[model samples]
Target chain A: MFLRIDHVGIACHDLEAKIAFFESTFGMTVVSREVNEEQGVREAMLHVADGPNGSSYIQLLEPLSPDSPVGKFLAKRGEGVHHVAFGVPDVAEAMGELGGKGIRLLDERPRHGSMGSSIAFLHPKDVGGMLTELVQAPPPRT
Target chain B: MFLRIDHVGIACHDLEAKIAFFESTFGMTVVSREVNEEQGVREAMLHVADGPNGSSYIQLLEPLSPDSPVGKFLAKRGEGVHHVAFGVPDVAEAMGELGGKGIRLLDERPRHGSMGSSIAFLHPKDVGGMLTELVQAPPPRT
Candidate 1:
């Protein structure tokens, strides 16, 4: 089941510039930055505000390679909101349920995603043309 | 300053269908529904999860007229996410600060928005091609 909105992914050609805009205009700060080679994106997560479930993040994603998925998205759509990720209890379980309900999924199985979470993407066509990602956060440290 | 993300505006051709999709898929319930003639859209707000600031909503917006802003957006871009609205303490003050910083605002002044909030939109070109809205909630009743 869905828990809360984890982050809203924004596709950008320049991560630093986008991060700077958010920081200067909205008073947000980048909490973490990393190159996700598997996804072919250099991403930075900006801390926005605290929620009851957790803190919300504005994720800035810059494509590393032109052929990468994010790269294709940028070339075709230009820079904008790419996807909305919802925090769930378990990614695999959520995917299974959605698939069982005849929903099309880009990821039939959960895979590693940014910020130590397992993530699966639902197809845009099936979700009113919005790229929706289901994310399950890693277990809390003991 | 932005307090938190209030909702993500989703443009849909059929408000009821989109509402049903969210209800069945995410187990979310509609918190409120209304038609704003000025905006020329029928909208429904669904409660997703609670945060420290407040609950985030998935807003379904269906244009009432083909010439409406949302209608134009749908005809050009198809159904998908429209804009992201951030909760602010004072819409007027926020507008002044952003304007003073040279941000191109679609709404130079706060205007009446759905759900009893004063809202202003920032141009997409200035914010990495993402249309952003600043919202000030109605004061709490005594």
Candidate 2:
């Protein structure tokens, strides 16, 4: 049902400092940056490596407001892996399939995600402890 | 230094049930399973997807003893992501490089990990509240 790991979203209190640490310490590179108002996050995608399907990323997320999801995550759990997104062909289909199996979804339908992707989240409680995301990338530009 | 995410290790109280969850819900398949005495955990690597570099996995770890590291994690934080392992060409070199950057090391030297890999862990405190592992996979059989 899934393709590969799209990205690992990390909740960061200080996105700049954390990005620097990943770059200087781990030698990772930043491929893209965006501020998603709907998601209430200022995020950057750090390139982990290149491969056949596509490049994987370590996504650093800093909430724009304290009431946002990432903000709440940092307030409760501090800095850590927030969620893991698996690449899917269709986010809506994946959501429907999982929901049919008694899984709780945070999003009723696909929502806009970073890099023109459609995404929906599964409830962490129902996922056995980890917040899971289903991401479907937009078709390649002609 | 790091090539790609080797696996995301998740702490589970019941490995059987969790593996079943991934299989039934996400359609992930178990690629490998192992019991590591030194790590004090029974682990199974579930295939997330395949790529040029290799396949990524969601590793489920169940502590053999309550006193083990995974056990302590479950007791304190409940079931969730235990650690994220990054693939590297040389475990010792990666350890030395990170150590030189003042990042504390949980293992002074590479030790046996699940599936005959050389692995060393980084201190979670220094790593922004998430345990990190550097993994050097065994060479391909000739």
Candidate 3:
């Protein structure tokens, strides 16, 4: 089941500048940063506000290679929103349910994602032209 | 200050079909629906999940005329994410602050928006090419 909005992925040429803009303008704080070589992206997760399930984030993505997905997106569309991610209780279950309902998926199974979460992407063609990601984080420790 | 994500504006060709998709696929419910002749669009607000300050919504927008802003957007880029709206305590103050910080604004002043909120738009050229809206709602009644 969908829990809350996890993060809005934003593609940017300069992650630090975007982070600074968000911090000064929107009062957001970068809580985590990582370079995902597999995804060919340098990303920073900025905490924006609290949601019902957890905090929402503005995920700033900077491409590490010109051929990467974000890089291609930037080349085609320029910098902008790359994807919208929703927090789910279970990524596998959500993907199965959506696939059963006849929605096309970019990832057939849950895959590794930033911030230690299992994630899968739903095809934009089937999701009203919005690249959407479903993320399931590890259960909170007691 | 930015409170929480109020909604993500999504452009669609058919409001009903998109609403059905969200309802069946994401388990969202339509909380509000209206046709804004001023904006030349029919919109449906679907409740996705709640946040600390307010609930987050998926706002489906269908253009009413070919010359409308959304209509032009759909014509040029096809249906997709249109804009992201953030809830704010005061629209005027937020706009002034952003303007002072050199952010170009689409709206010089807060204008009437759906759900009776005062809303202003920031120019996408200055916002990493993503259209952003700031919304200030009337105080909730006790």
Candidate 4:
């Protein structure tokens, strides 16, 4: 099951400029920025506000390659929301539950996501044209 | 200032089917359902999960007429995300701030939204093709 919304992924042509826009225009905070080579994007997370589920973030993603998924999304849709990620207690468990439900899974196993979280995506075509991601936060350090 | 993500507005041709999908597929709860004649849409808010800011919703919208905004969106873009609503203390104040900042607002004054929330929209053309909404919740009952 889902715990809360993890973040909303926004595709951008210029990550820094988008970050500046959100900061100056919306008064958001840039909490972290990192490059996920596997996902083929450089991304930044903007802290929207504190919530009961925790602090929800708006993730700005700039594709590292034109052939990447985010890059293709940008090319087709221009710049906009690429996906909505929901926070789950466990990605593997959720995947197991969703399997064979007529929903297509993008990953067979949990993969690394931004901020050390586990992630898996559901095909947009299978989920009403919205690319949805299931996210599980990395276990806290002992 | 924004508090959290209030809801993600999703355009749908069949409101009941979409509501059922969220309930069975995502296991979300239907918190409220209303018809806003002014907005020309029948909408149902699905509670995704509780969070620190309170709770976030997935709002399913079905147009009342073919000429309505939601209807136009469905006709052009098919079923998908319509807008992302961010929770604000006051929508009018946010409009004032966003005005003349290259962001064009759809509402000059706060308009009646589903569940008595005051809502305003920012044009997608001005915001990188992503329609954004500012929403203020209805005041609690005495």
lDDT of 1 by residue, B23-132 (tens): 99878999989999988999999987776665678899999999999999999999999998888888899889999898999985788887788999999888888899
**Of candidates 4 and 3, the better by DockQ:** 3
DockQ, Cα level, model 4: 0.71
Clashing pairs in 3: none
Whole-model lDDT, model 3: 0.89
lDDT of 3 by residue, A15-74 (tens): 999889888877788899999897899999988688658777789999998899999999
Which stretch of 10 consecutive residues in model 4 chain A shows the poorest summed lDDT? A48-57
lDDT of 2 by residue, A24-140 (tens): 988999888999999999999998867665567899999999999999999998999999888888888888889899999999999998888899999988887999888898889
Clash count in backbone of candidate 3: 0
Cα lDDT tens digits, model 2, B5-107, are 8889999999999999889988889988899988899999998766665557899999999999999999999998899988898999999989999999999
* Alpha-carbon interface RMSD for all candidates, in angstroms: 1.3, 1.4, 1.3, 1.6
Task: Please rank every candidate by DockQ, starting with the best.
Answer: 1, 2, 3, 4
Q: What is the lDDT of residue A14 in candidate 2?
A: 87
Off by over 4 Å in 3: none
Of 2 and 4, the candidate ahead on lDDT is 2
lDDT of 3 by residue, B28-121 (tens): 8999899999789999998878866877788999999979999999999999999988889899999999999999988878888878889999
* Residue-wise C-alpha lDDT for candidate 1, range A28-139, written one tens digit per residue: 8898999989789999999877865666788999999999999999999899999998888888889989999988999757888877889999998898889999988888
Q: Write the per-residue lDDT of candidate 4 for residues B1-142, one digit (tens) a residue.
A: 6788888888998999889988889888898999998889999999876655556888999999999999999999898888998889888889998895778988879998867789999988776578999998889889
Using TM-score as the measure, name the better of candidate 1 and candidate 4. Answer: 1
List all candidate RMSDs to the true structure.
1.1, 1.2, 1.2, 1.4
